[model samples]
Target: MPVHNMHERVLSMGSEEAGALLDSLSAGTADRLWPYDNWPPMEFDRPLSAGAKGGHGPVRYTVAAYVPGVWIRFTFTGPRGFHGFHEYAVLPVDEERTVLRHTLSMRVSGLARLSWPLAYRWMHDALLEDSLDLAERPARQARWSPYVRLLRALVTRVH
Candidate 1:
């Protein structure tokens, strides 16, 4: 089946400011956008740009396209069954506001069809929401669902 998931936030900041946050992705300690404190850190073989390869934890992908602070797309390379890409986009809402969006579009096959719905989907949702929280400072933290909490516990024990 096909899956299209998105999480977005309208922040009281200019597009340039939001774009700066996008540029900070995977920048180690300098990164202020990804919620690495609560989840697996997003890492890449090199600085984020077109063709960069990396992913958080078990997921893997290569940067298929990049446009500085404006947008970036990553095409998946692992987990066996994810067929497609995920991306982040910065959209100017107004002079003082911008919309930051993360989108995951893919088709799952074989085990992923089951794993995605049973485990990955829940974790993905929580992670993206936390990511949005990080993008918008002073925002309320995104809460984890009971299932998500349980799944996280299981993964923690195994790893």
Candidate 2:
């Protein structure tokens, strides 16, 4: 069977930094890249245009979540094999280490999982991992201010 796989990566940066960029994602960003925006804002970032500043390759996606952050969701054809609703919770791996992981099947499973394979190959195996890493690296270092303001605005709007 072509397994519906879950791919995760830990940037050298901690969840704190990752969370910031993760929080920056909004309908604006999703409309530009993937479809849907109800999934929790992820600890990732994707740039709007090819080779844009602080952009990784032709795409840039970032997020900063606080639940204490925002909640967002979506669907897309990309690496990670038709990524479903992914969730993350930050924790210290060591006294000075932290990690964020992607949770698979939080939504859209069963038939969707079985059906995604052929059409979402860009989202599988080696290619999927690298594509996500492309955006993760730069977003780890992405500026915190925009993310800060963005998160605040989102929280205010929701409440």
lDDT of each: 0.93, 0.38
Q: State the weakest 10-residue window (summed lDDT) of model 1.
A: 133-142
Writing each residue's lDDT as its tens digit, candidate 2 over 25-69 gives: 333453221212322332233442222122112222222223522
Residue range 39-126, candidate 1, lDDT tens digits: 8999999989898999999999999999998999999998899999999999999999999999999999989999999999999999
TM-score to native of every candidate shown: 0.98, 0.39
Off by over 4 Å in 1: none
**Model 1 local distance difference test score:** 0.93
Evaluated at residue 144, the lDDT of candidate 2 is 27
